[model samples]
Structures are given as C-alpha cells and as structure tokens.
Target: MSTLSGKTALITGSVQGIGLAVAKVLAGAGARIAVHGLADAQQAEAAVSAVRSAGAPDARFFDADVRDVAKIEAMMAEVAEWGGADILVNNAGIQKTASLADADAATWDAILAVNLSAAFHTMRLGLPAMAERGFGRVINIASVHGLVGSINKAPYVASKFGLVGMSKVAALEYASAGTRETGGVTVNCIAPGWTETAIIEAQVQARAEQFGGDTEKGIADLLAEKQPSRRTSAPEEIGELALWLCHRHAHNVTGATIPVDGGWTAQ
Candidate 1:
C-alpha cells in the first residue's frame, strides 16, 4: 500500500515551483490532493489534474490568497467537504531582495504577510481539525535563510526564521500525542538552499544585469559562493524529502528545521 494512501493533503501555493513539486510527490504516494493557488482558477485546476495524474484518487482546487486569514478559513471550510485535511503544506511565500537600509516598509510587510503570516493563518485554521482528527502533517517550505543570513534579503530571512521557530513550537505542542491513540500531528519545516526556480532565475538575471555578465555565469557564481556543492537543487529533491517526512516512520521527526541545502547551512 502507498505510504499516504487514504490521506487528504492540502498544499497551498501549489500551482507552480516547489509547491507543485510537493503536490506531485504526495499524490504519487496515493494521497488525495487539494491544490491551492491565489486566484488563477485555471492554473489551480491544472494543478489538481496533475495531482490526479500522479496516482491521487481524488484532487480538487482551492483558490484563496494565503495572506488573507478570512479566505483561508473559508477555504478550509470548502476543504472540509473532502473530509478535512490530513496533510497541510504551507508553501505560499514571497521574497524581495533589499538590504535593511534599502528595504521599504511596504516590501517588508508584503514579505511578512505572504511568507510568515500566511503560514500562521493556515495553521490556525487547520490545526484544530488536525488535533481533532488526531492525525496530520504540517510541512512549511522554509529557506536556508532561516538558519543563515543572506545579503539583500532581510525580510525574507526574518520571516523564514520566524516560521522555523513557530514550527518547532507547534511540533512540541502536538508531539506528545500519536495518530493511533489521539491522531496527533507532526509539524516540520524544510529549508531549501539555492533552488533552480523562477525566483532564483530572476535573481540570477538581476545579478547578471548588475554585474554586466551572463546570467548563467552569475548563477554559477552564486552556487560557488553560497552552496558547498556549487550546484543548484532541483525542485524534485525537496519534493522527495517532503514525501519521506509524511510517512508513518517520520512521526518522531517533528519540530525540526531540516535543511535540504547543498551544505549551505553546514558552512
């Protein structure tokens, strides 16, 4: 039998990138998927279809901005029709590259709202249902910045660090219970290093423009400087780790900020 067979997973911001990768991985393991996106119904539907194609028996789309608490609550109600959530992946986040001195209030607020507050909103609404069911998995897609600082990314780092802290507390609060006995949940965060996503590509391009060099060279330089492997990570790697964490054996691994970085945090 599949590891997550019969479980229902709600993955926020799963229309693309790492979020989509996680959805595909979980669905491949035989879980029902709730593919979420901000507003693009068509994209959300496509995500649902992709999950269904990946061996999920059931898949649905949830359209709601993660930054909005009320909308998240409403989406949870809609998701309740699918028998509530057994897995919750908080992957909705935004980033802006600006040093503290250059960072504006608007940019900081936007980063915090989407990257940190959104996760909190989802957890607040989803936790009770998880606690009631006595079984749940909450995975937050954090960043290596959560453990280490990065240049021109103050807000992103702050929000991710906060997420890591929050995840640990939530994990401890629920760790004393178990699914077989009380349906208790495990909460963990995955902190990815330099990933080859659209966001990273944009950063590469921006760096290239700033230095008057090729984007490929800029990207390589970034890897050489920050990542010990001197290579960018594929989205599937994060997806695989997330899948592993959802298995029954991973129950004891909660409250941990697992780094999937290329030894970025190790250095």
Candidate 2:
C-alpha cells in the first residue's frame, strides 16, 4: 500500500519550483492533492493536472494569496469541505537580495507578508482542523538562510529564521497529544540550498548582467563558490526528503530542520 493512499495534501505556491516538486512526490505516494497558486487560475489548474498525471487519486486547484489572511482562511474552509488537509506544505515565499541599508519599509513589509506571515496564516487556520482530526503533517520549505546568514538577503534570512522557530514550537505542541481516536501529527522544516528554480534563474540572469558574464557561467560560479558539490540542488531532491518526512517511520522526527543543500551549510 502507498504511504499516503488515503491522505490529502495541500501545497501552497505549488504552481512551480519546490512546491510543485513536493506536490508531485506526495501524489506519487497516492495522496489527493490541493494545488495552490497566488492568483493564476490557469497555473493552479495546470498544477492539479500535473499531480493527477503523477498518480494522485484526485487533485484540485485552489486560488488564494498566502499573504492575505482572509483569503487563506477561506481557502482552508473550502479545503475542509473536501475533507480537510492531512498534509500542509507552507512553501509560498518571495525573496529579495537587498542590503539592510537599501531595504525600505515597503520592501520589508512585502517580504515579511509573503515569507513569514503567510506561513502563520496557513498554520493558524489549518492547525485546528489538523488537531481535530488528530493527524497531520506540516512541512515548511525554509532555507539555509534560516540557520545561517547570507549577504544582501536580510529580509529573507529573517523571515526564514522565524519560520524555523515557529515550526519547532508547533511540533512540540502537537507531538505528544495523540489518542486512539486521534492520529498523531508531525511538523518539520526543510532548508534547501540554492536550487535551480525560476527564482534562481532570475538571480543568475541578474548577476550575469551585473558582472558582464554569460548567465550559465555566472550560475556555475555562484554554485561552485558556495556549494560543496559545485552544483546547486535539484527541486526533486527536496521533494524526496519531504516525502520521507511524511512517512510512518518519520513519526519521531518532529521539530527538526533538514537541509537538502549539497553541503552549502556545512561550510
């Protein structure tokens, strides 16, 4: 039997990147999927289609901007109608690489809204349902920035660091409360190193323009300098780790932060 044969998973920011990869992995394990996107209905539908094609018993699109608390609450209500969320992947986040001196109020607010506050909104609304059902898996897609520091990414680092702390507290709250009628829940965070997603593509292109180098070479230099493998991580690597965390064997592993970076954090 599949590890998640009868489960339902909600993955935010699932239209692309790490979120999409995680959705596909969970679907492969036989979970029904609720794919979420910010405001693009078509993208959301396409994500659902991808999950279904990957062997999900069923998949549906949800339109909600994670930064909007009202929208998040409404989306969770809709998801509950479909039988509540068994797995929640808080992967919706935005990043900016500005020094604190250059960071403005608006920039800080925007980054916090999407990266930190969004996770709070989702967890606040989704946790009650999870507690009621007594079974749930919460995976927050954090970054190595959460554990360490990075240059020109103050807001991103701050938001991610806060998320890791929140995940640990949530895990402790729900870990020892399982009953026969209620299933157990596990909450964890995954900190990925630089992955070659659309976000990184944009970063690479920007760096290339700034340094007068080919984008490919710029990307390679960026990876070689920081990542021990001399390569950036793949989104699917994070997906597989997330899949493992949700399995039965992972029951005792809550409040932990797993890094999928190719030894970037090691240095």
Candidate 3:
C-alpha cells in the first residue's frame, strides 16, 4: 500500500464502474482526484462526493468528452493549472459490437477516438510534467480483446489492440525518465475480461433470464465460451491492481499489459 499524499490522479470516465472504483481507492491513499466523465449534474456531483467520502483531500469533476481533442485539451489545461496529473489513467472507452461488414466508418472513428486516441492525447499532455517531477504512472484500461480477436467487435477489438501497442511505445519512450527513488515514469495496460461492470450487464441480464432467473447458471453460461475460472471480476479488484502499479516500487514495471481475464486469453 503506497501513499499518494499530495499526488493528483486524473482518471477519465470515472463517473461509474471501473473508473470510479479506481478513483475511490486512489482517494483512500490520499490522492486528489481529477474525475472526468459524461454524466448529468447530480451524477457528476455524486461522483465527486464519492471520492471525497473515500478519503480524497479534494476532488473536482472535469466534463471532458474525450472523443473531442479540443475538450481534452481544455480539461488538461484546467488540471495542469491545478497541478498536472501525476497519475494518468486512460480508462475512458466506448464500444460497439458489429462484424467487419456491419461496422460503419462512423462507428470505427468513434470507437478509435475514445478507446485509443484519447489515451494518446492525455498522455501527450500529461507525461512531460510527470517526467519533470520524476514520477508518473499511465495505466490504460485495455481489454482481453487486445490480446485476442473476438466476433462482432471489429472496431472495439482494433481499438484495444491499438491501445496496447500505443502504451508499449509510450513506455519505451519514457522508460528512463526517472529514477527508482523518484518512482520513474511508467506506462502499462491492464487487459481485463468479463468484469462485473455496466459494460457487461446486458449480457449478464440476458443470460440470467435465459436460465429462468438462475443468475449463477447464467454467469456460468456466459463464461462457458471463455473465462475458464467461471468467475466475473469485480471493478474494485481491477482498482487494486491499478493502485499497486502506482506504488513507488513499481517504477520498473513499464511496457507491460497485465491480464485479469480469468484465463480467457490463455485459451
């Protein structure tokens, strides 16, 4: 458990699900949170309140629609003015399921913009300061799709794979930026599969209903095709991994994409 006192974490898409979980845990470690996501007024304020309650010294919401470069720039500027991000989590993403033939150009563009390009923009804007400070962490929330191909998800899979490759490049670029004591800058990806987030709720619901309300069976059914562990990871579990990477000792763990897929990729 590393302390992030005086540190500021900028997590995109942090209003709910995995992103929110990351914010809460980082907040518990005394890091100020720069929460960014798309949500209504009440939900946005609630997100801020959640992190504060989780023990953040302070938390501010940034309304950045990551698909737009201009919005990301404005958001980064605001965060920079407040003291640039020490930890940048590229957790914002959008996904649409469609086969190659059915995947339209607009869908590809949107998915690529949010899932891949947003990370690039944020890192470009944030990493320099982290290098100057001699400490930085960029944790990208990629997917198992990054490691393997899946059906009816051409754009999503492409974006995740691109994200993984991009992180590797960034990691190499900044590998020697900082020293061990400074907790050197590092870029990494967490490739998660079948996590219990809203992203998979529809599948879960449909499966559960398919099995006559037998939720456990439905989950098993869903996991049958992959996920040998037959388990769905919780969002907080992913947060725990992110927190570990933020530790000073994790300075050397760059250019790595860790899988939390319950053996889905192993198959």
What TM-score do all the candidates reach, one by one?
A: 0.94, 0.94, 0.96
**Candidate achieving higher lDDT, 2 or 3:** 3
lDDT for position 150 in model 1: 80
Candidate number that wins on TM-score, 1 or 3: 3
Predicted structure with the largest lDDT when compared to the true one: 3
| Selected candidate, larger lDDT, 1 vs 3 | 3
Native-to-model Cα distance after best TM-score fit, residue 132 in candidate 1, in Å: 2.5
Off by over 4 Å in 2: 179-183
TM value for model 1: 0.94
lDDT of 1 by residue, 186-226 (tens): 99999999887876866888768856878877887888888
Candidate 2: residue pairs that collide: 134-183
Per-residue C-alpha lDDT of model 3 across residues 60-90, encoded as one tens digit per residue? 9999899999999999999999988999999
User: lDDT scores for all predictions?
Assistant: 0.86, 0.86, 0.94
- Top TM-score model: 3
- How many residue pairs clash in model 1? 3
Model 3: per-residue Cα lDDT at residue 165: 97
